[model samples]
Structure formats: structure tokens, C-alpha cells
Target: MFVDIHCHLDAVKNASEKIALAEKENVSLIVSNSVDIKSMEKNISLSKRFPIVKVALGIHPSEALSMNEKEIEKAFSFMEKNLKKAIAVGETGLDFKHAVTEKRRELQRELFKRHISLALEFNKPVIVHSRNARKECINILSEMNAEKVLLHWFLGSKKLLFEAIENDWLYSIGPSVFENPAVQKFALLSPLKNMALETDSPVLFNGKPAEPQWIPRIAKKIAKLKKTPLKKVETVTTNNAFRLLGLQQKG
Candidate 1:
């Protein structure tokens, strides 16, 4: 069975149908991450309704840029109250691509730190989104001494990637791997034990929204890049997902 370690199930159109399709494709678990308070609540409800759905509650960096202090606090409060329901703390990290101003960057960093702290407090892995700010994100994560880290759709410099690998962080390979040679290179460079699969559903890929059912295809791509057996890729990545997210595998 496969596991989608990161996705936005609440944002997907016809979410129920897509989830059923994923199940038919042997996707046993989908860790849906929240980008805002509303998504957090929706994902929580989705998890209760579907056994395969799990949640990771946090504020996205881009979302944080627009939120006022009061709103940010509200999100943090909600996450703390519902942290027990989340398998991880994420969709959180630095996104300098959108955080244009220095002040905005600082805000993102502070919020990211708080999310990491909360994850540590609860002993949950952190699924991060570090776009155009990989260095700062990695530095902050290292400063926090975070042990369980998953860099979702990671695209960093080779030196930084090596640093993360040295830290033993897991990277989630998404469907874009099929089209993006950089992503394919990432898959090849990353050790099988340090890799997991994600769809990041609702994100566009080749002009279509990705879904959890794309996981097997992503795994196949990784297998081809790594020159490993398809079954081995599936087994290792699925095990990596369960281990990092603290989920129990079904027999």
C-alpha cells in the first residue's frame, strides 16, 4: 500500500470521489495539510469522515503574510486545541517567494518557529514548505534541533540538500517529478530510506490538479531514477511515511 504524506484534501474538487479513487489505487493513507483556520477545520472533519484521511494543522507562509497578529494567534490557538488530531504540524515554513519585505520574512520565520515548537511539544513530525527560502528554513529547523522533519516538495541547492540529508530529514517527492528534471534529480540524489511520496493534491501539474492516485506513478518515477525495483520503492517510501508521521500501518 502507498501513503500520500502531504496533500490538501479540503481544497480538492469532488474530494470524496478523489479519495475513493486513491483508495482504489492502493493509497492507504493521505496526510492532508491545512493552509488556514478554515482548512484546518475542514481537514479535521474530513479525517473523521474518512479513515484514510489524516491532518497536519498549521498556517502557510503565504497565508501568514496576509494575516494580522490577532488572526495568527487565533490559528495558533486552534491548532493547540486540536493538535491531538493532527499526525504532523505543517504546511508551515518560509516562503520568501511571497514574503517580499524583510518584515514579512521575519513574520514568516517567527510563525514557522512557533509551529516547530508546537510540533516538538507534541512530539509530531513537521512537514515543511520551504520555497525560495530553503537556507533560512533549514537554518531555523537546525537551530530548533528538530528530529522529525519532512521537507515537502523540496527544491534546494545541492549543498543544502546534502546538509538536509546529513541531518537525516525525509523529502517528499510529488507528481511533478515526472515533468521536472530538477525534481527527478532530487529523487535520484536522495536515498530511498530518506524519501516519501506526496501528491500535494489540488496543485496543478501539467494543467491538471494532482490527486493522491498519482502516488504510485510518482513512486514508479523514483524507482526508474534510482534504478530500484518498483516494489522496493513502494515499500520503502510507504514505510518512510508511516515512520516519520507516526502512523500505524495496516496489516
Candidate 2:
């Protein structure tokens, strides 16, 4: 069995069909992260209906940049009220490369801090969405003393990554591992115990769109990169996902 620690289930063309495809590959746990309140609500309903669906609530930096103060606050309030059964506080963090304004950058930083604060308060793992803002995000996270951190599809330099490893933060391998040399290298650098798997569905894989079912293939690639057995890759990554999400009930 495999675990997809990050994916936007609501972004897929047909969530039900894709989920069924994942089931055939034994992709058991799907952590569906939200970009906004609507996405959060959709994932919440999905979790109630699908045993494999686990929800993580947060706002994407890009979306936050475009959101007005009122919209951001309302979405945050909604998240706080509905965070009871959330698996993590994530898909949240800084992205310095996006088309955000100088003023928006400050707002995004404050909002992202709120997410870190919420995660710390709830004792939940944070699935971060970092980009060129690695230094800033890491500095803030370190300052706040987050309990558990999962840097999703990390694009930081090897130096920043070492800092993350020193903190024992987790990394989620997305499907890009096959085609992206950087991602492949990250898989090799990351210990099996410190890595989880994800598809980031709706994103392209080769020429086609990715889905949770692609996790097994992604795991196989990681296995190849690490020169380890596929079963070991599957086992370790799944265990990492479970530990990061605080879902102690193992599969």
C-alpha cells in the first residue's frame, strides 16, 4: 500500500473516478489540501464520504495574495471553526516567485504565520507550500517552533534543505520526481523515514494530468533513485505519512 500525503482532490476532473483508480493501486491515504474555504468545505464532505480522504485546511499564497483583507479573514475564520477533524494545517506558506505585490507579501506573511500558529496550537503537522521564500519561511517556522512540519514539493536550495533535515522536517515527493532532476535528487537526499508521497493531481505528469493512482509509479521512481526495494519505499513513505498527519491508526 502507498499513501499520497498531498493532493488537490477537488481540482481533479473526476474525483470519484480518480479515487477508484488509486484504490486499485492500494493508495490508501489521500491527504486532500485546500486552497480556500470552498475547497476546504468540499474536502470536508469528501472525508465524511470516503474513507481514504483526509483533509488539511489552509490558504495558498497565490490565492492569499489576490484575496482582500475581508475575504482572507472570513476564510480563516471558517477554517478555524471547521478545523476539528482536520488531519493537518497545510498547503500553506510563502511563495516569493508568485505575482504578489509588496503589500500583499506582508499580508501573506502574516496570514501564513496564522497558519503556523494554528498548527502549533492544535498540535497538528503543517504541510507547507514554500518556493523561493525558503529562507523567510524557514526563519519564521523556526522562530515559531512548529511541532511537526511537512514541506510539500520543496524547491529550496540544498543548504535550506539541510536546515530542514536538521529540524527533522518531512518532505513529500510529488509525481514530478520522474521528469524533474531536482525532484529526483531530493528523493535521493531525503531519508525514506522522512519522506511521504503525493501526486499533486491536476498537474501534468509527462503529457497527462496526474492522479492519486500515480503514487505507486512515483514511489517506484523514488525506489529507483534511492536504489531500494519498491516495497520498502512504499512501507517507509506510508509510515512517514501516518506519522506526519498524526493518524496513528496504521494501515
Best by lDDT: 1
**Distance from true position, residue 220, model 2, in Å?**
0.5
Candidate 2 clashing pairs, residues 3+ apart or interchain: none
Task: Report the C-alpha displacement of residue 3, candidate 2, in angstroms.
Answer: 0.7
**Per-residue lDDT of model 2, residues 1-251, tens digit only:** 88988889978888999998899999988999999988998999888889999999999988887788798889889888878799999789988788457776787789889999998888888888878787888899999998599888876677887888888888888878888998787788877877888888877866798899999999899888989999999888888788777777553
Model 1 RMSD in Å is: 0.9
Candidate 1, 1-251: lDDT as tens digits: 99999999999999999999999999999999999999999999999999999999999999998899999999999999999878999999999999999999999999999999999999999999999998989999999999899999987778988888899889888998998988888788878878889999999988999999999998888898889999999999999888888777777
TM-score of 2: 0.95
- Score residue 205 of candidate 2 by CA lDDT: 66
lDDT score at residue 52, model 1, on the 0-100 scale: 93
The all-Cα superposition gives candidate 2 an RMSD in Å to the true structure of: 1.4
Candidate lDDT scores, in order, read 0.92, 0.86
What's the TM-score of each model vs. the native? 0.98, 0.95
